[model samples]
Target: MNLLDKFDAVTVEADFRITPEDKAFCEAHQAAYDAAIQSFHELAFFWEDMENTQKELLGSKEDTYLSSRDGPEISQRRINAHLEWLHRAVISNIVYHFNSTYHVSVRDDYVANNLLPQMPDLRIYENKEAREAYHKKLREAKIRYEDVFDQMLLLLDGRSFTEQAFHELAEKCHKAAWNLYQNKANYERKKALISFNGYFCSLHHYSWQDEWTLEDKTQDILRGVAHYETGSFDVYPLGFSELLGYQRSPNNEHEFSTCKKVKGLKMFKNGRVDIRFTSETYAAEFATRYLGLVC
Candidate 1:
C-alpha cells in the first residue's frame, strides 16, 4: 500500500483514537507546527542575507565595534540562535505532526514509541571541542541543514507519513539541523541545577562521597542521592522498600507537583535521593514534607 493508505488503515483501525480531551491539545500542536514552519522560512532567509553580508564585509576593517571583531561575534550569535531555533522547531514539528496526523496522544507518544530521533544531550553543545568534533563528523557524512529542511517539506507534503518514514526523516533532519550550529549550539536542556552535594552531606551529617564531586556539571539533571544538582535521589522511609514520590507530607491531603520553584526527586543506583529547590521557601517546604524538619 502507499503511504497515505497506511495512514488511513491506522486511522480506520483506531476509530476511537481521539478523545474529547485531545481537542485542545491537537489544536495547540497544529498551531505550533504552523508557527514553526513560518519561523523556519524567516530564519533561513535572514541567515542567508546575514551570511552574504558578513562575507562581503570581510575585507573592510575599522575601529568601530560594528566593523571590529564584535561584528563577527554578533553575527555568530545570530547564527547560533538560528540553528538552535531550527533544532527545537524540527523536533517539535515532527512530534506534533505525527500526533496530529494520527490523532494520537498529543504528548510524547512518538518519543515513547521510538518514532522520533533521539536528541543529543544538551550538555554536548557546551563544550567547544565536542561541538567541533560533531561538526567534523557531520561534514564527513556530507550532511547539511538544507537537507533537514527538505525532509521537513517532504513530511509535510503527505507523500510519506508512516512511522518508519517519520523515523527515517526525523533522524536525518535531527542530525542535519543539530550539526548546523557547530560551536554555537548552546541550548539549555533544563533549569540550572547546581551541585549541592556538600550542603546535602553536611545537612545529613554524613561524609561526602568523592564520586559525587566528579559528576558532569554540564548535565542539566543528575540522578543520585549524592548529587548536588538537578537529579533525584532514592529515599527509603522506615519499613518501606520503595522510596517516596515526594508528592505529599505524611499527613497532608494535597500533593506537591515538581515545578520551577519546587523541584524534587531522582535516584541513582545505590545512592540516596536529593532535592533542589528554587528558593528558601520551597526548600523549607521540602524539609517539612520529607525530612520532618523545618529549613
Candidate 2:
C-alpha cells in the first residue's frame, strides 16, 4: 500500500521514550543535577532567613515594616534599610551561584534557565508608598516556579527542609536533567529537516505580537493560502513542491511529499509547532521534529 494512504488510515503518537543511551547521558551529567539541588537548598536558606527576619520586625502587621504612618520615621528607615540589605545579599548569592554553575552572563538568562521564580527589585522599596505597593504586588502575585529552587522557596512555610522534600527535589532534578538531554537529542534529530528534507526551521520562537518573517517567506515560497485567526495564522503549503523540493520525482522523495498536507499547522506563539496528520506515522514524524516534549 502507498505510505501516504497508510498515514491517511491511522493515527500515530511520537515515541519520546527515554532510551538507554539517553538515560546513560543523564547519568553522566550527575554533577549538573547535584549542582541544581544545591542551588535550590541555598535559595531556600535565604528565603527562610528573610521570612524569619520579616516576621520578627513586622510582627504580623502589614503596616509596620516600612510604613511611615504606623512607625517612627527612624524605625521605618532602619527596618527598610535592613530588609534592603538582606534582599541584596540574597540576590547577590543567587546571581553568583547561577553565574558559576550555569554561566548566566545576563539578567534575562536567569529567566531562560528557569533559575529565579520572581525577579524582585529592591528599588521598589525606596519609599513608603513604593514599599507598600511592592508588598501589595507580592501579595497579589501568583506563587509559581519552574525549577526546584523556586518551587521550594515559594512554598516554604518557615519550616526546615524535610527528608521527603529533599527526595522530591532530587527526583525533580533528575527529571529536569533528563528533559534537557531529550531536548538536545530531539533538536539534533530535527536538524536534518532543514537540510535534506527542505523544511524551513527557525530556532527563535516568535511572539504573536512580533513580526514573523517565516510567515511571509512561507507565503512567498510556497505561495500557500494563509488563514489568520484572532490569535494564530495557518498557512497551507499547497505549493509545497517549491519549498519541499521532493515533488520533482517520486523516486527521490520520502513519504512526506505523498502526504503533503500541512493541515492544522499551529505555531504556538512559543517556539513550538503542531500539525494534524491523517497518518500516525506522519504525525509522529512531524511531532518528533517540532513539538516540545516533557518527560
Candidate 3:
C-alpha cells in the first residue's frame, strides 16, 4: 500500500493505547514536573519579595507600587533584576536534571529564560483630567508587569529539561561516562513534549506512537488522554510529517526536511496528553487526516 494509503488505513479514535516504552519515558521525566513546580514557587517568591516592594508600591496603600512611575529604563532595570534572580535558580534546576541523567554533575549555569516583556510605559496621557486617567494607566501598568511574569511562570510551568537539548548533547557526550543516547528527533521531541501540560499530548508520543503512556514505579501503566476531550476537536494524531507540511521521499525513510516544530504542544507531569491548536485551519486538517473526519 502507498504510504499515504497506509496512513489512511489507520484511524484515531478514543481509548488509544500508547506503547510501554513511550509511557516509561514520559514517567522517567519526573524531574521536569519538579522543575515546573519549583519554578512556580520561585516565581511567586520573587513576586512577593521583589515586585511587591519595588513595582507594586506595597508600603502604603495610596502610594502603591506605581506611585513613582519610572520611565522605560527604570522598568527595564526591575525586569532585568528580577530575571537575574530567576536565572540563578533555573540554572541550578537544569543542572540538577542533567546530573541525574548522568553520573556527574556540572556546576555551570544553563540559563533558560521563559519570560517575555510587556512595555506599559508607552500609553499616551494628555492633560490634568489625564490625572484621573493616569491612575487607570498605573493600574494597567501593574497588571501588564505582573502579566509578563504571570505568563512567564505559566511558560515555566510547561517546560523542563527533556528536549532536543539532550539530543544534541547526547551525541557529544556519547563517549563520556554514563553515556547518553536518543535519536536527534526523539531528543527534540522530548523537550517539546515537556512544554505541554495535561492539556495536550506530547508530539514526541504522537509522532512515534498512537498515544502518550506512563508507568508508575510499580509498573502500572496509564494512557494519557486529552484534558478536554468532550468538545469538538480540531486536530488528530496524524503523522507529524503531514501535519507539519514536511515533505520527503520515501526512499529516505528517516529523512525529514524541516526544523520547524509546531509550537504549543501540551503535556502533564503525571504523564498525560492534551491537544490545543494554534490555529483552527491546522487543527481541521489534522482532524481530517488521522481522525477520519469526513471531507
Best by TM-score: 1
Please give, for residues 1-295, the per-residue lDDT of candidate 3 as tens digits: 4222323243333222333643454344434544544554565466557545764554444444532545333333454354334433444444454445432334433122223222234444345465445443322221122222233224322322232222223222221111124211111113212122222222233454443322121010000111012111222232332323223222211211221222233334354433334445544433333222212
lDDT of 2 by residue, 1-295 (tens): 5212232222233232334643454344444434544554455556556656877887765443433566544443344434333333333444344333322232433432343234346775667787676544432332112232343333332222232222222233223222344333222222223111123323332363232222322222222112111111223333333333222211212232333433333233333333344455544443332222333
What TM-score would each prediction reach against the true structure? 0.26, 0.19, 0.19
Q: Regarding TM-score, does 1 or 3 come out ahead?
A: 1
lDDT of 1 by residue, 99-215 (tens): 455432233333322332333567976788877665444322322223332344344343333333333322332222122335221111223222223212111122542222212
For model 3, how big is the CA root-mean-square deviation?
21.6
- Using TM-score, rank the candidates from best to worst: 1, 2, 3
What shift in Å separates residue 71 of candidate 1 from its native position after superposition?
A: 9.3
Q: Which of the two candidates, 2 or 3, achieves a greater lDDT against the reference?
A: 2
Candidate 2 Cα deviation (angstroms), residue 9: 15
Worst 10 residues of 3 by lDDT: 218-227
